[model samples]
Target: MKKIELGELLGQMTVSEKVGQLLQLAPMFYKGTITEGEITGPMAEMGITTEVSENAGSVLGSTTASEMIAIQEAYLKTNRLGIPLIFMADVVHGYKTIFPIPLAIGATWDVELAEKMAAISAKEATAAGLQVTFSPMVDLVRDPRWGRVMESTGEDPHLNSAMAASFVRGYQGNPDELAENHEKMAACVKHFAAYGAAEAGREYNTVDMSMRELYQNYLPAYTAALEAGSKLVMTAFNVVDGVPATGNEWLMRDVLRDELGFDGVLISDWGAVKEIINHGTAANSVEAADVALRAGVDIEMMTTCYLENLERLIADGALPVGLLDEAVMRILELKRDVGLFEDPYRGLKGDVDRQQDILSVEHREVAREIAADAMVLLKNDGDLLPLGATGRKMALVGPLATTQDVLGAWSWLGDMKDAVSIEDGMKAQFDQVDVAGAMDTENVTEAEIAEMVRVAQDADVIVLALGESANRSGEANSIATIRLPETQYPMIDAIRALGKPVVTVLFNGRPLDLHGLIEASDALVEAWFPGTEAGNAVADILSGRVNPNGKLPMSFPYTTGQIPVYYNHLRTGRPADAADAQEHYVSQYIDIPNQPLFDFGFGLSYTTFAYSNLELSSDTITKMDTLTISVTVKNTGTIAGKEIVALYVQDIVGKVSRPCKELKRFTKIDLAPGEAVVVTFNLTEEDLRYYKPNLDFTSDPGDFNVFIGTHLQAAFCLA
Candidate 1:
């Protein structure tokens, strides 16, 4: 388990064995459950022999602790060095007791809750015998059309960086004691370096950006995760500077390893190593293997390039034998660090009872609580929410009214049948509740509309649950338009014609262009695919048992044409002023305003909050001084609520162009009616620092504007 022992084990491994250690295959190869024909078909296609599978270093995904235990036991008996196989899976949000998606978690703006949820995910994943989770995806995105935007925290580097560090802390626990902490697993911060900036918001599209933009906006969250002691890093599928990330030596070695100082195991996304050939960076698998290894990819996932060509390349003297040795040593070091050498079956020992730990009642309670806080009240006109003891007849309609598909993408271990339905939650609260559910989003019939109208005509209020299906978002599922499906518009129109108070609950993954839906509904709630206790959480918010406190992490665009709308944008020379719209010689859209429908950090609570008496400790301060900014925030409405106060700073001048505003810090506070508290934040010179044109991160001394909650502004000078 020590360094000397790891070296001795590596020294005993043959060339084929060393190559096999750098190859990660699926569990089916080691399970031996398939027929010879089935095995040979895939093996021949991948150009890997059964022996490669026998000595493979890691398993992609094993379903249960028993399966992992069996696989590791079988693999060690045959492996000459007896190195254990590490189990890894995309345990993104939750394992079995599903929580809200990462985007919804971001809306909560509660990093503590995010960390707690991640710890619960680790608890469940470790019960299933996974040692590594490819999660805490920290890619910052401004485009909502990209399906993977749901995986990232948001567009801001600060929020994403904080969330990334919290996830690493929750998953890895203490870096030094990670091997003994069986409840936790090593976190793998993934899709390294600007994957969210994919061109056209398309999956796997090319990413082209300036080095200044890369260092300033995209790379901070990854660096934050590594600083928090993440044990692994996964390469992005897209190219950086015209080279695939898996094969870009400058990117992986120079930036990620040298600059960021990440000396952990670097693995490629599934089949990304072999796909380097398709990127035109390599001619064949042999070249692909050589290129990826040179780029410092420690493991090639689900690909035969490393297994098939590494040994030959080393023998031909085209590649250094030390490259292979370096990779194998890192893999072994990880194996030892995770206690695989000492225990072999870390959390998968005998008497494994998955049911006791998988989805307990306590886990579901935490899921419900988090889901409730993540629900954003986008619109609450006329105070229609908190339906309370009104004794009003309620009707639940639309496609998602009674469905259990609330668990969003990447919930591989969660079953839809286990999800709570809106109808179930509503019926538990109301004495009289009717339901006319439409299951199809793209195909709604006149008969179905009539059925919905007939059911809701007698009801005093309609709770319309409408959204894109679970498959419409997440990896490989990008849409052209960021609006509701056209078919659902007919139902919305029908429900509006009934002349009843309508409350629409959206179960989407991304920020939608809510043009028609907003007009048709009196109240709107962005539920965002609440998991497990989805219906119960929505009912809690609607019934006044819980208050809506979530805020938007990404901006909701005005239309699909405004694809990359975000709050933090550069101040151009001729910026269009809203006060002088007639002065149109500047950068303004002819048909639409440049602003989004909803800005970042926008959300409504059941109660109102008033900000007053903005104060700065000093009007001017030197670079070494920390300026204290404070504002008194009061709960003006007649109920207790939680408010997320944000702090933004603008650098007046810099060596390079800067955004008009950038979020530096934010905090959530709970206040009761008539209770006011002074929220304080200290801004230092380091907080104003940014990437210069020459890639130096430092601040410029100049005049600056500071904003708290978007309205309270104060000016200060750094002399």
Candidate 2:
């Protein structure tokens, strides 16, 4: 269909039909789907009608191709224009063949691998008949206390931007090609404008920050995702400045649409429009609907505010009909773009072969590969890892040893029974493997600890699978203290007392306070949530089948006291010296050291790497000249491994205080034993640009120090 046809369709829609096009509800509200049921209480409460339900532009949460087909097929019978309903869901990480969580994908530091994982997720999700995924949540998170940090890539804007673009490309292919492509689904970059910086790291708390800070830190990744051609943006539940994002005109219109040039669908985050009343921004549902529509929100999700009040608002001359026409046109264009106007089901007509498409062998292999690459080796004391499978009797003991809740949150379509446990993967690799532990982390008993110790006594090495359960992190799951449950400490202490070398594998979603666990374990693996291939990936790393190459995307704090520890932070006047702890009047904690337990970009390999011969092409350069940096990395240990070389820049002088070190570029390279290779990076003037105090984004001409992997430094001047 042509653009003029969309205009014609918009012109044909009545006031009620246009309002219905701006509303998105759940599939259960409609009939003929798998979850066809009555919600009389909710229906009466939200004032929903059969007419509005049949004419809703989209559905939020429905699984399976048959459900989508049934919903669309049944709905078209009632509508005069026969518009198709688009199905969207929170397919955050994966659909059926689950990969590692978004945070784990960031730890891989491989943008290509991240893109591959997302492509596989799109393949699986589209096979199940999903049309849009609320994914690649590009929120820059510095606080691990925020449970939604698992949804974000990390603290750095640059890394998150790179991952965001990669995810968009994987999900939608090219924006121009998304219209005709049936294998991929549309991508929605969510929680727009600093939802991650909620005060106190609490979920849905107030997000108060200066506009300059917002632009400098929180807004870049969202801009990058939009630039990469994401088709939709989700409004955040929190407030931007003093106004809720769902009803903030300056944020939605002046910033997102006008400045960022995003003209796509803007949907509210699960009744965020109605909740604006709770934020004291609106007096009632009527006011909320009027405000949200004027603020440029295209869809009111999970609420009937638009269905209930949009027509009245327009009749009272409060809202122009042109706004409704514009919104309806966008929805129609999206429908036409996704080929829904032509084929409402979008190739989901026939019975989908689950075995051949959903969790096929190819998909599982990609999941396993990504899961292994995403596991970061946080610690390895005296080379205790890579246990020899032939001679050693390995005992897998912990709450997560045999449980299949390895696929973490937002995996709506993933079944726990299909997930591989640590015990299952270990037994496949080793003939002598024993497992004994509690099945639940919070419900562990003394008897379970005693049994775990008994199993550890007979084994040469212990592979302790521990960490937060699948529910401990994700949206609305924030905790005050980012520590392991107290109940599990006894299990850790008991196994450590056995004097067996313990290689601890953590299945968590956020950075944790690892003070006690670090002391009790010989080796530590930060396996965030490896999805369906959890056990096999852990086994590969433990048995020397795959080397651990993942790095820390977020810093591990010493304790919860240091809640928001990150590498790139503004310089202070009086900096604390780690050499002198007694010094006062500095930014240092009295009880604990200021440094993080494990810094960002910190990871280990079974084989070690040595950096040498740092050189720069020139000491000075103009704005137009590109500076070349070179460093040689050697695999010092006697094994093949991948090394991540990180490059950071420190601006000596700027208009405002700048971060002491900021990551500019990084690369992952494979090296064999005793092999060396020169890694080079071209640094242009664009790399040094930052927002000034007056909000002007430009690079400064000053002295800069380039550090390679936190050690080798070379001084240069940007002239």
Candidate 3:
């Protein structure tokens, strides 16, 4: 479909039809067996008629194939131009064969695996009848209180950007999957413009940050997703800089469209167009429609505000007809681009695919590989991990011990029955396994603890599963505190007193305050909800099959008081290290240390790597120069392991104060024992850029401290 043809098609639409094109309704609007009264449920209250529902441009939250095909066939029968409705859903991690949550995917630090996961998700979702997925949430997060942290990659801009691009590439596919065969779904990069910066980590709270903060840190991932060919960008629900993002012209039009060069469809998050009135920026739904339309939002999702008020806005001259035409044309063009007009039943072969290939043996293998890589070793005192399951009997204890709740939140399409539990995974490898604990506290009584302790004491070792439930994280489930539930403490204390090898396999969505368990356990594995193959993946790490290689994308705090701790903090004027360690006037916490329990880019492997001879091609460089950095990493342990070599830059002098360290480049490489690899990073002038004092997005010339470390495992072999 050419631009003129799409525009002409838009021209043919009546004002009512054009308004209908801007609305995206849920499955309830189109499902056949639904009652008429129920069908008019919310839309009628919002002044939208059944006519608008029948003519809506898109549908979300649909899972069945026959029903979706029937809805489209029925709609096209009465439609004049015969346009196909694009189906979209929240295919966050996977469709049926769920992978680890986004946060766990971030822990893997494997761009290839991230892409693979997105590809599998797109394939499975398209097979089940979706044309798009609201995924690859690239929000950079620092606070763990936000439940949506599980949906995000992590706190670092560089890592999040890399992951975002990989996800877009995977979902949309290189050379375009829709162009190839319509097997892949269009990717929708979401919560645009610093949604993770919600005040005090509250969900739907206001986001207040400077333009420099926005451009420098928060906006990179969204731009990267756009640059990587995502077909849509979803507006955030919260207000940014005193204006709701769905109605902010500078945010949606100037920043997202003009600055980031996103020419794709811009859709509002669920009911966000209506919520603009609640933000006090719009007086009512009529004004909210006017505000959102003029702000460059192409679609109003799950709301009748646009359907009810767009024509009114145009008649009153509050909205330009060209804007509505443009929005409608974009929808038609996208539908055509995805080959929906060519075949409305594009990826609807999932029922057969499900029987043959959807979540087949090959997909499970990929999930297993990703799940293993996503597991991070937070602690391994005395090298107690990699303990074989056969030689010794192990007791698995915790709320998640035997439950199939391993798939974290946002996997609405996934079936929990298909998920493998920890007990199941442990029993496969270990000769004898004793399972305890419960997903809810109601089942975990004192009698349960006494019995579990008796069984656990007889075992040679204990594998304790711990962490937050799926409902505790993801979308509007933010928490004021991030400690493990107090109910589980009695069980933990009982297990600790057993004098057995106690290893904890944590299964939470966000980083938790691990001050108590840090000393209680022999080993701690941060397994943030590894999906479908969760049991086997952790079992692989517990056994010697796969060495731990994952790194933390975000820092783990010692306590909730140090909530926002990250590696790249700016240097304090009155630094704790600036004076004597015992000095009272220094900027130091009286009760706790001023460091994270675990730093960003921090991880442990079964083997060790030594970093030596960090060197630079030149001390400084001009605009025309490219500085080269090199560091030698040696595998010192007997077994082979993967090491993540990182390059951090510290600007010694700048017009604006800079972070103490910023991650520029990192690479994960596998090394055999006694083998060495010299990792090199080329730094061009663009790598040194930051938002200047005058807000110029250019690099300032100055001497810099080039820090190179092998996953921070080396204090420096400085020979």
Candidate 4:
């Protein structure tokens, strides 16, 4: 249906019917039928009646093709206006064929791979009868304590925005293809606004930050995703500027709709609309619905606040009829955009190769490539990796070696049995592979320790795996201490004490506190939960089949006390310029060095890269001019590998103090051994812009420092 026809259809519905379209329920309605009226599950307390249950606009967390077909077929039988129920689910990291987590994808620094992963996810989800996915979470995260960092791309706004736009492009495709193609679904960029900045790194905690911080760092990714044509935006659970994001007008309307030009449907995070009452911004469900509608949230996800109160809110003149109609129109228009109105099935009710598409050979190859690309070699001394030396015996020991739970959190549909473990991968390539106790125990048991030590001593080298479990770092699983388990670190130390060359394979979601692990192992690989193909991908890198090229998207804090550490931090009057310069006057810590263990953009490869002879089109640039800065990078090692060329700009003088360095642009380029390439980056006026002290975005033309390459000590001055 067109806009006018949709509007006419909206006009034909009563207030109760319109409100019903905004309520999104779970599978309870279809468990038996509306006649059963089984308000037993989560919907029991929501006061859902027969009418509302039959009329819920969409279903959440249900992705099976037959199940959705059944729900939609049944819903249309009773849906008064004949509006089809839209199906939405979380295709966060991946569907059944899981890929690496968002953090691992970020480590790759390969937007193309990230995009391909999203495309595969969209294709698999669409084939399974899902029309929309809650994905591409663009929250700019810096704290690893927040368990949801696993969902975010990384700490940098630029990187996160690039990944966010890629996900939107991959999921929705172009506007032309998005409608008719079931393989392409609507992308929902979420936890809109700064949900990642939960204070104290606690889940559901209040987020209080300056407008400058929000605009400079947090808002870019959300804005980028919407600009890339995402169909929906999910409201965050935390408060921004003292009001919950679901009910904050400035956030929902002013920033998202007006400034960002997002006219698509705006959704609330699960039960966020009702939780506004707990935020102390609303008195009850009535006030919650009133405030949320006023804030312009279109769809109330998993909440009865709107279902029970929106019509009465309109009766009390708290909400206008036009506003309600506008929201319903957006939701209806989204359904139409997905071609749900044209063919309610979107071509999924017919024959489908569900298993083949979900776990396709081509999709598994992409997952393997991404997993290989995202593995970061943190420490490799004396070329200890690649295991290229002949007659090598690997004593594979540690907790994460044998587990198949490599698919990180939010992968609700990924099958653990399909995952490959480090042990499996190593055995595929090596001759002698000894496996030991992979799970931590209460007491080391002298016999187990003796067995592990014997294996370690007998082996030519040791490959030890260690990290948090799969459930350690996604949503509501925040941790105050991100250290390895009490027993795991001791195991690493004990293995190191064997005097064998120990290689630590770190499998984790967040940037762990790795001060001890780094010191314990001779070589380290940060293999953040690589999905179903985790073992093969790590084997590719570890067995010299693929070179490790990933970098740290977020900084590794020296200790949990050094939370919120990031590379793009603003400079202070007396910055701790020295690594260990702890003085009473300067901003330094007395206990330890004021630096991250693994800095952002820091990663090692088997092949070394050299940067020299930096050149710029012009040393002086104005608002109207674009500077083409080129740097010559050469592979200085014996192996060929990809290098992430990063461009960071430091505004030496500005209206307001800017970050010490902000990543403006970056690209990944591959160079053969001893081969050189001139990597060029264009610095436009937009790259120089920053939030002024008075809140106006303008750049001050003055001296600027430009850093190129991951080893960016060769700084160039610009005017």
Best by lDDT: 1
Alpha-carbon lDDT of model 2: 0.89
Candidate 4, lDDT over the whole model: 0.86
Instruction: Tell me how many clashing residue pairs each candidate has.
Output: 0, 0, 0, 1
lDDT, candidate 2, 1-719, per-residue tens: 88988888888888999899999988778878644346555666678877778788999888888787788888999988888888999988888998899999999999999898888888888877788999879999999999989988899988999999999999999877766777888999998879999999999999988888899889999999999999999999999989999999999999999999998898899989999999998999999998998998999999878888889999999999888888788778777778888788777774656435888888889999999999999889999988867888888899999999999888878998889989898898888899996868877899999999988898989989899999999988999998998899989999999988999999899999987799999999999999999999989999889999999988988899887899999888678964555478788888999899999988989998999999999999999999999999999999999998989999999999889899889999999999999999999999999998888899999999999987699999999
- Against the hidden reference, what TM-scores do the models get? 0.98, 0.98, 0.96, 0.97
Mind giving the per-residue lDDT tens digits that candidate 4 earns over 396-434?
877677878788899888899988888888888788888
Where in model 2 is the C-alpha error above 4 Å? 34-41, 350-355, 578-582
In model 3, what lDDT does residue 632 have?
Answer: 88
Worst 10 residues of 2 by lDDT: 33-42
lDDT order, best first, reads 1, 2, 4, 3
Which run of 10 residues does model 3 get worst, by summed lDDT? 710-719
Model 4 misplaced stretches (Cα beyond 4 Å): 31-42, 352-354, 440-450, 578-583, 710-719
Instruction: Please list the Cα RMSD from the true structure of every candidate, rounded to 1 decimal place.
Output: 1.5, 1.6, 2.7, 2.1
Question: What is the C-alpha lDDT profile of model 1 across 1-719, one tens digit per residue?
Answer: 78998888888889999999888888777743445566677777777776788888998988688788777877777887778899999998899999999989999999999999999999899888899999989999999899988888899999999899988898888878878978889999989879999999999999999888889889999999999999999999999999999999999999999999998899999999989999998999999999999999999999889887888888999999899998999889888788887798885665656548788999999999999999999999999998984589999998998889889998888999999999998888877889988768667778888989999999988999999888889999998899888989989998999899999999998999999999998999999989999999999999888989999999999999987989989877777874655587888788998999999899998899999999999999988899999999999999999999999998888887789899999999999999999999999888888988778888787999999977799999988
Among residues 3 or more apart in sequence or in different chains, the pairs in candidate 4 whose N, CA or C atoms overlap within 3 Å are 399-438
In the predicted model 2, the residue pairs found to clash are none
Off by over 4 Å in 1: 32-38, 350-354, 578-582
